[model samples]
Target: MHLQFITAACLLASASAHSTFQQLWINGVDAGSSCARKPASNSPVTSISSPDLACNAGAAASAGVCQVKPGDDVTVEMHQQPGDRACRNEAIGGNHYGPVLVYMAAVSDAKSAVGSNADWFKVAHMGLVSNNPDYFGSRVLNDNCGHFTFKVPAGLAPGNYLIRAEVIALHVASGSGGAQFYPACFQVNVGGTGTVKPPTVKIPGVYKASDPGILINIYQDLTTYVLPGPTAYGQASPVPATTAWPTTATWNTALQPSTVPTVVPAAGATGIGKA
Candidate 1:
């Protein structure tokens, strides 16, 4: 009886740390689940090569496509569960430390883009920012109430695109397959006149099981961390973070809306919110 109780407690504790990107903030406006292709559950995709590694397992297709222009300050929001955006609790509880990466893929249709084969390009990545008493990007995300913002490339061509937001939790990454990946997708139509197409790579093929970033020991005294995936849109290389990443909360929790933004379907669009 005692062993069973301990195992149950352990399982509950482990489950508390799992999270998913469920909301989006465009130019500081709460877009909510408008164009979000939220996963079926707030769970981790363990297999690196699994097709689920792209958007997430069992994520339904989204019919709503958020309209946005280039150079918008887009923020991806995460929490332990859907529609639970309390600032009192950590967005992702437990010490599920790792990196926060965002990738973008251009497609013919944002609403129907299958993430498995689409060409994805890294736009923003935040890995280990400090080592002396190590601080990770996941920690920064928690500090900001689960909001990580990045800008849409000003030179990106106007078209349909999928924004893939991911958080890798390395708490149990001492072994080969112990890492946890939580990725979510958002569909958007970029409506600018710019016409620059960045380099791209497929999702499942971007992350290798043997890659040092995917398979690493964060507990050890580490000086550098190699970020996974291809080079960012305009960067020369994936530079390893060396400076001390800030831990203070940037997103105003006091002003956070208790409810998600109401998504009004566009003209001729039948339905909206979580297909």
Candidate 2:
């Protein structure tokens, strides 16, 4: 029985490492209604070309889409569940660290928008550090560090849009097709008077197997990590100020990640073992 228990423990730890996009909040409201993977999904979208890349394509339209003013602080939180009610950061193993990116595209209508053909515009991106050369060190995916806040441009036009959040893990990126892509999409309806149109790109076509960010190693000593994709439209000097920042905003700190204790799962032990 002892031997059997040990094996089970190792397997459970491995199981928890499955990268999944469990929850996403828009302007502080739970927006799972517009996402393809509901709160109950068991796994994340692993394929770059899966229909999910486009609003997870076929799930019926959701009522959770948000109606927001241009200056709103669109805070987004991505979490990974190791088990039911046991939530943690999106990144688990040291191998799963890279850049976190968000994009937006105006849709004809929020209620009828499915993002497959929508031309996406780069809006927000976070992957830079003055301390870490790799830009994305273990700090990105460790210790419940999966939350991000997107500031809606005050100059944005009023309309329906789809927002895409992505995190690329470069641990195995040394080889072709080795990088793992985890992306989640949100539908929103913005209400404002500003009118600054942003450039757009087609999905699946935008990301290549050989993209610089997608095929690199995070462990190597580096100085700078160039974020892939066209610079977000209208991302010029004096970016729009964040209006009414959330009291619970999770800023991507440039400081080194502080250490935190973790429960080490015993090798081959069952039931997650004793801490």
Candidate 3:
């Protein structure tokens, strides 16, 4: 009976490692779950050409759009299941090492926007941060309790925008079509008067299965890891082959909310974590 119990525990742990982006934090405030259109499951989308690569597979539409301004620090949080925000577990476990990317697309209606139909532009990206320690973006996220933070481009035009955060797990990416893509979308209303529209790329068209970054072996000592998507807005492509990416995490884990944030109605305004 003891042996059987041990086996079951291991199985549960393995299943929990398959994660999804489940929460959002804006400027150090927990924006709650309503703003995020989280995937129904933690399973990954392997096909790069599928429309599911845009937001996720079967992610129901979200009614709430979190409010943000240009230059606000936005963080996306991931976990194996909804409302599972434990700090001890790795966000994407089982040696799933790869990059964390964030994209932004202006839309007519953030709450109802179809991710596949929007033109997405890269906003932030983090790949292998260090070779000596063999640290990856996934590791960074795990260190911070599944939170990956990036800033809204300074001059982004104010409007309804869809923020897509993704993690590309390259553990089994040695062969073609082996990379696993986990993407989640969030609705946000930008309130700045800034007007700058960067170049955009379609989701299904951005990543190719044959891309060097998507079809590499992370088990070996990789001198460089190329990011699959285009250059982030107002930032140059990071050359990991020669330059070392900073290992310091910008998001403060000490201030992390112990409980998941929730929205409360007060004075005709819905509070944090709600629309």
Q: What is the C-alpha RMSD of each candidate to the true structure, in Å?
A: 5.4, 12.1, 5.6
Best by TM-score: 1
Query: How does candidate 1 fare on TM-score?
Result: 0.88
The C-alpha local distance difference test score for the whole of candidate 1 amounts to 0.82
The lDDT of model 2 is: 0.55
Candidate 3 regions off by >4 Å?
Answer: 1-16, 241-250, 262-275
When 2 and 3 are scored with lDDT, the better candidate is 3
Off by over 4 Å in 1: 1-13, 236-244, 264-275
- Give the per-residue lDDT digits (tens) of candidate 2, residues 1-275: 87466446444543455444434444444333344333234344446666565554334455556666676666444555422223234344534666667788898976676666788887767554332333352234343345566677778888888777777766566677766666766667787788977778887667777778777755556556667677756564222122321223134333212331122212232221000
Candidate 1 local lDDT, residue 36: 92
Kindly indicate the candidate among 1 and 3 with the higher TM-score: 1
* Candidate 3: tens digits of C-alpha lDDT, residues 1-275: 97576456544543446889988877667776768897978999888989999999999878788888899878789887778877766778877778999999999998788899999999999897777656788888887778887889998899999999999988777789878899999988888799899999999889888899899877677777889999899998765534454545455655555576555112234223311
TM-score of 2: 0.69
Candidate 2 segments whose C-alpha is farther than 4 A from its true place: 1-16, 26-50, 56-60, 82-94, 130-138, 141-145, 236-275
Error of 3 at 219 (Å): 1.2
lDDT of 1 by residue, 1-275 (tens): 97576456545645777899988877776778989998999989999889999999888877678877788778898998889888777888777888899999999998888999899999898887787657888888889888898889987899999999999887766678878899999998888799989889988888877778878877678887877887677766444456666676878877776788648334333222110
Worst 10 residues of 2 by lDDT: 266-275
